[model samples]
Target: MNDVVNLAEKLAQFSEHWSPRVVAELNDYQLKVVKLQNSFVWHKHDDTDELFLVLQGAMSIRLRDGDVSLQAGELYVVPRGVEHQPYAEDECHVLLIEPRGVVNTGDAEDTRLRADNDRWI
Candidate 1:
């Protein structure tokens, strides 16, 4: 747990979009890195909020009320139970912060969109 984690280096290890690779853990929460392209399914976490921090390029989180745009070095937190659909025009890198075991697809019924949890880089 004392080893340093490099976001860029880890990001280069994988090219699969929407798959989050666990980078580190803080108490009950985990930090994950993911590559995003196109759009993600609309889903919501009933128990915990999800944080999306843009590491490169740009992305948007579409909510029922409005949409939140984020660029590199920026972040947005989707509150618990708030449905959000993430979209990116081009490939974007993102760092996610959420509770351990929190599903990337949240409550979405489409199993194909769900990513494997606890995958470390």
Candidate 2:
């Protein structure tokens, strides 16, 4: 069985950004960690909502209406079916809480930045 997870330690296991690694699970949701830099694709999940909690640096979620900025310890929820793009000027660490099997790229078929399902750190 797995013991308590150290987020900073888990995050240190990977080098690439924009890809989320599963860290823990609760009921039907998964807690994931990801490193973010530059920009991500514009996409939306029709089946479930996505939660982003910043752990380090800052993040900016670009929506059609406007942009939502988040700093360390801050969070933002992208409601289901809403289009959004995430980016960071510098490297950012974040925790993503969402339902199991939720795709990283949502329903978008851009073929870029598609993370493997159930990947763990």
Candidate 3:
């Protein structure tokens, strides 16, 4: 029999900071969970839009035009081709919904690239 996986349980298994783990999949899209602090690299997905849903804590998105702050239960959509950076003062849990093959770092090829792809908890 298949076991049911709860997101809260899956998130509990991860302790690494700033790394995103795959949690589920819907069609060609992937659902990811990540804990974040400080700031992420400035990048943009030239092909697909990215969605960020705050599960806990708070986050801020820095864009070329301005920045947006997100609290718990808040969500933001970064359109394709728009450069942005994410940051948080305290640790934050977020759910990211995006298309398959979309890199977490976008066009950036830094050490922060999360190699795990499309993995489901």
Highest lDDT against the true fold, candidate: 1
How would you order the candidates by lDDT, starting with the best? 1, 2, 3
Best by TM-score: 1
Residue pairs with backbone atoms closer than 3 Å in model 2 (clashes)? none
Q: Candidate 3 residues 34-89, lDDT tens each?
A: 88889898989999999999999999999999999999999999999999999999
What is the alpha-carbon lDDT of model 1 when measured against the actual structure?
0.96
lDDT of 1 by residue, 1-121 (tens): 9999999999999999999999999999999999999999999999999999999999999999999999999999999999999999999999999999999999999778789999998
TM-score of 1: 0.98
Order of candidates by TM-score, top first?
1, 2, 3
* 1 or 3, greater by TM-score: 1
Off by over 4 Å in 1: none
Candidate 2: residue 74 lDDT (0-100): 99
> Weakest 10 consecutive residues, lDDT, candidate 2?
103-112
